[model samples]
Target: MSIYIDPAVALSLRGYEMPERLGFGTAMAPVMFRAVCQDGCWSNGELIPYEPLSVDPAAKVLHYAQSCFEGMKAYRTGEGIALFRPEKNAERMAYSAKRLCMPPVPESLFLDGVRTVAAYCANLVPGNSGESLYLRPFLIGTQADLTVSASTSYEFYVIASPSEAYHSGNMRLWVEREDARAAVGGTGDAKVGGNYAGSLLSIGRLKERGYDQSLWLNPADRSSVDELSGMNFFAVIDGALHTPALNGSILEGITRFSLIDLARNLGYKVVEGTIHIDELLGQVASGTCTEAFACGTAAIISPISVIGDDGGSYKLSQVPGPVAQHLRQALLDIQEGRVEDHFNWMLSVETVEV
Candidate 1:
């Protein structure tokens, strides 16, 4: 399909200036990518000004919650500007859309939308370490129907943010025992708004109790470790890296995947297995587990210092884990083009002339 570049988009981008301080996704780029689908047909994507969206009050997304999104970054590497494994984000978004009973966005269209945004907004890509142009691509059921069914129409949007790295340093995590963010057979593995919405209350309650994020447990067993609110969980036990195995419920994090590979390449033993919460806490207490951390696209790696519940608090011997620190830097080096792209992961983007 043909892509349209609106003349107004260029003006919008040129007039845009980066704020002095960008708090994660709060700083929005001036232009955005938009496309619509009707009766299972997709229109050509367009580059347009970022503006408030118009949606009917009775839209299906408003009621049934058929929405999905992917988080990615456009990095300013030493060579030039580029994106990190965008195709993975595209594939994951399609998986998420399918889980919500929505049509999967075609890969070519997804790549085009993000690449165009990154190319045109290359000037907005942050130059500092751990900073980049954050990209959020989302699709919502827009058929303006109140029926409890999937909408026949949809709208896809790609928005950009020039922002700082999310650093939840030496976090104190709460062992969430009550609320289940996603169920055993639910959208736990999918990156959808509802899953995050369900987790907010837990995060809020934890924050009130002096914790950073919720360490959610498996919905089925309610015993094994699942993941953090949005990131994957990892622990360092006896000088080896251990994480929860994928069981059709954990959201497969791109960073988590990269870290495992990077750790092994760096000569650390990485294991993916089921970790019971009680057992892990005991290990922490016994000094067998020295470090733990959560990882995702936004934060890259956030070290976890303590795990607490009503019973007690268990602290890791290492506040900022050696494995986490090593892997985080290794991944960032490859991402920032400081080291060789041995994994062949980074995708370069030639900036579009304004």
Candidate 2:
């Protein structure tokens, strides 16, 4: 299907100015790609000027929270411009939609939506080393009736933001024990908006406590580390890479998977299994766990300096350990096209002529 580009999109691009500081998903691009689905068939996509969406007051999404989204990036590469592991995001988005009982966005449509947006906004992609165009693809239930059922009509959109690395410095994490973000068999593993909404209060309370993020534990046990609100958790324990296993409750982050493979290739022992919360805290307190960090498409890798719980606070011996630094740079090198992509992860985008 052909993509329609509204004339206003061109005008907005011509008149737009990028801000000097892009602190991760703050400054949105002026154009957007949209497509709709009805009765299980998807319509042709269109590129138009960015604006607020119009929805009925009783739409199912407003009540049932039936929405899913993906975060990926477009980087300036040796081949002009490329996306890092976009297929992974597409696959994950489909999984999220299915878990929410929404129609899955076919992989082809997902790629077309993101590539169309990125090709047109190539000039808006930041040139800085840790900066690029962050792409957000989302699907929502639009049916007007709000009777606690999945919407028959759905909408898919790809919006973009010019962004730099998410966090500027080492992070402080608050260990949440009182409230559970996701259940064992719930939407915790899915990239749905409701899971994020449930985490906002934890993040809000921690922000006042001088913490940068919340390290959520598994919902079933509440004794094993799951992940952060928007990222996956990792730690360097005893000269090995330790990350939570892909439990049903942990969102399988693209960056987290890639780093595991990257670290293993770099002669590091990477382990993915259950990590007891108390045992991890004990290790951190005893200098057995030297470093802890989080990764996602938004924040590549953010070092965690402290983990605070009701019992007490434990500090990592190295906020940004040598292992994290090495892996981060290695991953960045592959992402920014500074090094060879031996894993065939980067997909080059053909600039579409308007």
Give the per-residue lDDT digits (tens) of candidate 1, residues 1-354: 788999999899889889999889998999999999998899999999999999999999999999999999999998899899999999999999999999989999999999999999999998989999999999999887677888999999999999887774678899999989889789999999999999999999999999999999999998999999889999999888999999878999999998888888889999999999998999999999999999999998999999997789999899787778888888999999999999999999989878
Candidate 2 deviant stretches above 4 angstroms: 352-354
Clashes of each: 0, 0
Model 1 is weakest, by summed lDDT over 10 consecutive residues, at 163-172
Q: Using lDDT as the measure, which candidate wins?
A: 1
Single out the weakest 10-residue window by summed lDDT for candidate 2.
345-354
List where candidate 1 sits over 4 angstroms from the true fold: none
For all predicted structures, in order, the TM-scores are 0.98, 0.98
Top candidate, metric TM-score: 1
lDDT of 2 by residue, 60-156 (tens): 8999998999999999976788999999999999999999999999888899999999998988988888799999999999999858778899999
In TM-score terms, candidate 2 sits at 0.98
